[model samples]
Target: MDFPVLWCVLAFVAINMIGIYDVVHLKDLLPPLSMINAIAAAYLLDKYKLPNGLVALGIGVIFFPSMTAPIANLKILLGSAEPPIIYGKAPYVNPPEGDRKALGRWIKEHTSITDMVLVHSFGTQVQVYSERLSPTIYFNITQTPIAKARFYHDLRQNKPAMILIPMFPEYQNLVDADLRSFVSDLVKSNYHLESIMYNYQVFRINK
Candidate 1:
């Protein structure tokens, strides 16, 4: 065995010592032996048979996080790979959680006698707040800019009592010069800056 093979074996032994056995039940001895054998094969083949990238990838696969591993396994295991890059994995936020009542009073005080309608990006979750306020909410597509334009144009011509800006990613192109100016002028003159919610701006247009 070469230096790399010896190093991987040492790492594996260390992993077992550090309590990585909770993950995938390391006690049977077969998996560790299999891993050692793979490393040995990789070492011997590194010279003449196996490609360098393949050997390195094999080592990474053995050393990295197993998807089936228990949650705290990383704390106990050595050389654990970082969590994978999975798309659509939404980031988390921690809050005191849903035991407050002042927000109810705030919404009631703001939307009094106004037929408010909230516009948001689809699936951004403004609808939850709109329930008690009796305001309608419209949503735009997350991908196409053209869809956003059609939405903005519709909103301007209809002139809803209120508008909610969610600051979503897909609408940047639609928030161009004309759109910005129109919304800005409305906010300054007739629209009142109601409140901010989860990075969004709520504005009430006084008709």
Candidate 2:
């Protein structure tokens, strides 16, 4: 076997081992197994004997997204900067803009230090800017069966004061039916729509 392909195979096994450990221990995968997998795939593609054109195409596919920041920076230097498009494979030209800081400030003013908030999408930003406790930190409900159950359990146990659902331009929030049903049921039973911010909805738990 080609050395890089062999390396990729070894890396794949190592990553799976770590992943299994994380699942068994109810722990988050450190450094993200996806990143490790991506690196391994890149190495394999780089070393695998293939048509010159195909190799070039594969490398370009990997290289382009990583260049977004540099390209944006160059645009800034030339005084032609567009609204800072975020970096990723399916790049959006200019996403719908909203003042999250203002929303955070509002949350801070309305909620107490002890109040736990649940935020989807921009959980870290809300946590940092709002300075409130959030049970949803680094936890994604759709990732695994354990995570999904854990999310519901935490919601039941903590009864967080607020839940924020931001409207994405791509409407990713609407994709998961299971999660949507859970949120809808929770809203119907224990929460009410408190306010709608520029690009998000805040729901308050009934006291």
User: How high is the CA lDDT of each candidate model?
Assistant: 0.51, 0.63
Kindly report which residue stretches of model 1 are placed more than 4 angstroms away from their true locations once superposed. 1-114, 119-123, 132-138, 141-146, 166-181, 197-199
Tens digit per residue, CA lDDT, model 2, 22-81? 353332333344456666766876788547678668768876767777987799799997
Error of 1 at 156 (Å): 2.4
Q: Model 1, range 121-205, lDDT digits (tens) per residue?
A: 3322333444343222234232235544665666566665666554445345444556556556656776787776443467877
lDDT of 1 at 158: 62
